[model samples]
Target: MVTYTGDVTPGGAPDVRDAGGLRITKVAVDEKMSNNCYLLRCRTSGAQVLVDAAAEPDTLLPLIGEAGLTTVVTTHQHWDHHRALKAVVDATGAEVAAGFPDADAITEQTGVEVTRPVRQGDVVRVGEVSLEVITIAGHTPGSIALLYDDPEGHPHLFTGDSLFPGGVGNTFGDEAAFIQLIDEVETKVFQRLPDETWFYPGHGGDSTLGAERPHLAEWRARGW
Candidate 1:
């Protein structure tokens, strides 16, 4: 697992590292909301994918550099998460992708057409690297996560606002939504993935499945 115990705040430098065969760069775009924007590049082909255009276009655009953005993925239709979507897409002309149910909302908020409506079992290609789309609805009607299985090592999960460090995402006090989120997370993520799998959440610091698995019961009991 790639351990990064650094400052993840807006205006703070990005945390860049090599995991498996890909280059992963994580930056916090919106400081108050702690929204994390990730850039995943396929080392072999240099094809890049920008995940969640959170905020701070000035900071996010510069990070793209010369690699060229191939695609921009919106984890959900949350306004905070897509605050910089228009700017990034306008700069890179990248294809916009989002969950099927949230496509219309994303398009409305960002003013960029959602070219791809991703769903579970769909594979998003970034050069030769492939990311499997996992729909985990709870935080929103169309919340989704991307899973990249590193052939050389553990898998990498970009879990938007679905799963977090101490607990699952806030369900806005809705018990049914909370139940759905927990069920999907436990069934689709925790139970299916290995302990070493690294989950990069939409906000806050990164954590591994192993580190979080033991606290699943506690999280469920507390019912956040």
Candidate 2:
């Protein structure tokens, strides 16, 4: 009995639910209070990927187990993003993964082994889906996104904190380096994807490449 909720944001898009085939369920945890987390599900195989567990395991662990999640992947080493990471790892014995840069910190915090150290061009096979990893280091020195060709739709890009609906993510690392990384993501990743490709961000409601692509120029012009 998966219940659906309406959009609560002022100008945000309505909540979406995929009832069949490959699906993605948004579990708004501390994110609405601070940051957001998502659970990516493959209906065909009943396997899931937990992205950015921002709350306690008691809050999200049940959902993860219910969804039959197999892997936990972090967008970065930000504390808010991995709040329940250790718990999730202990509960499901799920393999934890993160970008290469934050491998050590993630390892320390979770105390759970990192099964895979992802980088650009690397693919993580989740059930039958292959998510091509895209390293976008801006908000954090180790931020990464997932890009995949969906079997049901055009394509999908799970942009951790690298992108959002209105603008790019925060520049917390080296300001100059972060800006350069933003530029790279805009050019190499976003621009390469089809216009209709979906952008599932880490902190906001979903937006399409067409909706976000035009805004990139504006973001760059404003020195984002």
Q: How would you encode candidate 1's per-residue C-alpha lDDT over 1-224 as one tens digit per residue?
A: 64665347887888987877688899997657889999999999999999999898899888898887999999999899999999998899999889999999999887889999998999988888999999999889899999999999889999999998888998999999998999999999999999999899999898899999999888888888
Candidate 2 error regions (>4 Å): 1-16
> Which has the greatest TM-score?
1
lDDT of 2: 0.73
Give the least accurate 10-residue stretch of model 1, judged by summed lDDT. 1-10
Model 1 spans with C-alpha error above 4 angstroms:
1-3
Q: How much is the lDDT of residue 56 in candidate 1? A: 89
For candidate 1, the TM-score is 0.96
Cα-lDDT of candidate 1: 0.90
Clashing residue pairs in candidate 2 are 31-35, 31-36
Instruction: Report clashes for each candidate as comma-separated counts.
Output: 0, 2
* TM-score per candidate: 0.96, 0.86
Candidate 1 lDDT at 195 equals 97
**Alpha-carbon error at 104 in model 1, in Å?**
1.0
